[model samples]
Target: MALLMPASLLMVSATTSADAADAPQNTTNARQAKAKGKAKLVAMPQIVQQGKKPASAGSAKAALTATIKPAKAGRPVALQVQKGKKWKTVSKTKLTKKGLAEFGAPISKGGKALTYRVTAAPYKGAKAVTSKPTTTERWLTASFSDDFTGSTLSPSWSNRGIYYEPDSLRECSKGDPSAVSVSGGTVKLSVIKDPTRANERCVAKKDGKSTGSFDYRLNGHIGTEGSVSMRYGFAAARIKTHKLRGQHGGFWMRPTTAGGGDPRAEIDVVEYFGDKHPQGGLTSFIYSTKNNKAVKTGSWIKSPTSFLKNKKDGWSKNYHVFSVEWTPKMYVFRIDGKETYRTKVGVSDQFQFPILSLLSSDYEISQMPGGDKKLPQTMNVDWVRLWQA
Candidate 1:
């Protein structure tokens, strides 16, 4: 099971300081949380999206989360709302390990609409960030999890395939609709010889393949881009892979803008090439541009097996839970809900989406032990789940 290690390493540290000016500071509408200062807010009143649930009784499913920019470690924040030009505090909580906060119904259901915002008072060396007013009943529609239960792909997913640029990002692979399929309560991603474009020329060139080389392969890739993009949340997937060479399977994320810059960059949650890889088969990474140079972190998690349930339950043989906690200042990666790697290098500050793929590159073709004989290897995902930070 496995994935992305760029050709060259960026010379930046993962725990470097990040500035508020580095992220998108725009506030959106009534459907989502509106921030006036430096914090990102989202409120979910139910486990699943509903018109509005009774707030008076209190709910275990109801939740409120905030992501603050220029994060202050362990800072206390007041969640408030304006009433007759007066912003009254509803409740207070301190930030988590990554400058994030989550609380249940700050104001118990009162049968009245309350517009809420988070207030982070100025602290030692940390400037204040005040959020805009957004109502409890009118919060962003919380996204539900996809368990891959049906025989077809869910509408939440879009086929993002046919990798044209033969750069390090895509290698020499293309996305074919047929390459991705859902069955038996699981999603399957495969890499197979392209029967349709067997002799068709490729569009881009890697060192090993040029435009004149015939199109020979297709990969399975599906992502949530236009249809639905999640902001900060915990994304987890239970996956099992094959120990094949020449390709890798991965789960990653990116903002809707698709640009390579600070706070709106790529998040490689997990990538596994195969079993017993030189770098130990699993890696987590982040990518963005800082100081006109790329900023990257997260690597082959040094103790991947420490989180495994047992020796027989390795990645290629069984499904394991891989998750990432996205707070304001950094990302914390984990397997089976236990921590693995944490970094502040490139954290996306806005709406981003999830992706799944099994890709190959012409540069790695020589590593396949069975060559084309092992053409249709696959990655099986038991389910995909998400919850706000």
Candidate 2:
């Protein structure tokens, strides 16, 4: 067991940046299984946090993550849960460089908790091994993700303008719940013409700056305002945009609306202007309007011709994982695992909830081709995941 201490240490510490650095070294065994040995299970925690509370009996996307000793880097691992009378393999994934395995399956959403364990296949001379059973924690876990599987948005979200706040963070638009829908396993936020409000009205200062009179646009937007906010985490979304230029789609975070919180900054994860324009139509921006004028950084991801899985795909035609790895010191914006931008100058240190919006700010209205003919453009989000530190 003495040989297992280091691996146990990693499980105890949950592989943070400080210790993850040593993970690679632990896997470089000279014998690579040529050395004779029985597969021995190392001591590890027996519980995994899925959400703040145990999932209801029918919940899906609840994940259980595990790590194994002998570091099975890049090797397939079987995740099983004890069923009726025997263990059943529910999912599988390769161990990461740090010997981590993460997989999730629908749990007893509202029933009693479920137990899960991981099994590693034999390699070299080492025999197969399984971790001790770990039970799912009841509702009240941390970290959350939504795969947009159900037909409706999770209760965690607020349709924003419907009851509390008004449309678009900038107020350049209004939100119409009808514009938001979930279909084909993705949440769609479409910028459809609000014919009811098209000639309705516009107040002074559509912030007062564009060529067109503020013709109203209804958008699809949702926020986590009163539900959840975290000071730092990796928040990401996989999305595909529409092919029109009039409205732009975005993923961003806003501070909780509680009175008397810091208004220091807003984290803009990713924003895509409709199809084809300069700078590849993708922008990662950070903004602060605390003292009246705006202070911002980040820009369009340049030369993105090869950023896609292939040249035939574009931001609007394909799904891209856009995320921000937010740490206390910096915010790293990435697209499809490629770094698009990074900056420490305006990273928000306070809790901020996430936002998904498709807006046609009066300021950028002229950029849309064929005008209203392109109405009903959408932003499809497959899922949103958050991992807090």
Candidate 3:
């Protein structure tokens, strides 16, 4: 880890300007990485002290709630709010018990933005073990874009049969290329999980329609190798996920190989497994070098505690902007301009020049029961873009 120095460390007093003879080496690294198009991970100044909790005075209130499915029968949920750097308990309520599965209250704190954390528990004796809890935290940023007109994302991204699922079958014409067209000014990719006649398929679809246990391959995956590799830049996508039910979808980049498999590298900007389990999450990972080891980092933003709780968040219905800024030293993953995870490892070796790819894959969620029903799922993407520094 690089030592983060305070910006105040460079203060020059009225007596004399700080001389170069006393400049610190850590400061030099920060300046160099910035010059090379890398973002510096500077630590925020620590809070000197948190004054006593402010009494609930003003009249602004907000509500946060968690719930279970099947109409009106399930466990309760809790929510936490972070004011500045401190976390304060906000609300707790029974999702099914009160007929009001959601909790709401006035947030007296106004003017500034508010961040929240939501949590849910499984039903009684449901066999769903609670793991780490999922966290949904967001702060406002001015650079967020809800548009997708000129991105590199398309149903026919690659030459051979679009490297992804189409947005609609009408566009695909019973799974043909002619029917697949970008509509509504957004790039949408959709897929079917039934037994297919195509040689290669989007095996990640969890539709439970496979004829037999046939060896299935993916329809689309991105790579910069061969004629598509990018050196260093910011790649992003304005994506809307499909109701995968039991699939994984997101943006990733992999190296292309000459023979059978791509042994070069795989960088997953954001991988979401639409499962109701703690293991399912939005993750970022890198498989580099000859070893194929996954050096990864991701945040369990939702349903981190239990997979069953994950299903209620509605990942498929929302449009999230997934992005990756790959520089020479670090890879930063962001969703809707909110920084979720950042990794700095083997910086020089793996990301020397990473190619960009957006992909979707599927497999068993676990070796436990009820896992088989979650296969044949699909992941949707709207559009993807690349920004060079």
TM-score per candidate, in order?
Answer: 0.60, 0.60, 0.43
Q: List runs of model 3 lying over 4 Å from the truth.
A: 1-156, 159-181, 193-228, 256-262, 290-313, 348-362, 365-378
Tens-digit lDDT string for candidate 2 (110-192): 55556566777765434566666655543223377777776888888877654212343334466778889986678899887
Error of 3 at 385 (Å): 1.6
lDDT for each residue of candidate 3 in 97-141, tens digit (9 for 90 to 100): 432234433332444445454444444522111112222211111
Query: By lDDT, highest first, what's the ranking?
Result: 1, 2, 3
Indicate whether candidate 2 or candidate 3 has the larger lDDT: 2
Candidate ranking (TM-score, best to worst) = 2, 1, 3
User: What lDDT tens digits, residue by residue, belong to model 1 across residues 100-165?
Assistant: 665545333455545567777766545577765555553232345677877899988888766554
Give stretches of model 1 more than 4 Å off: 1-142, 168-171, 199-215, 258-264
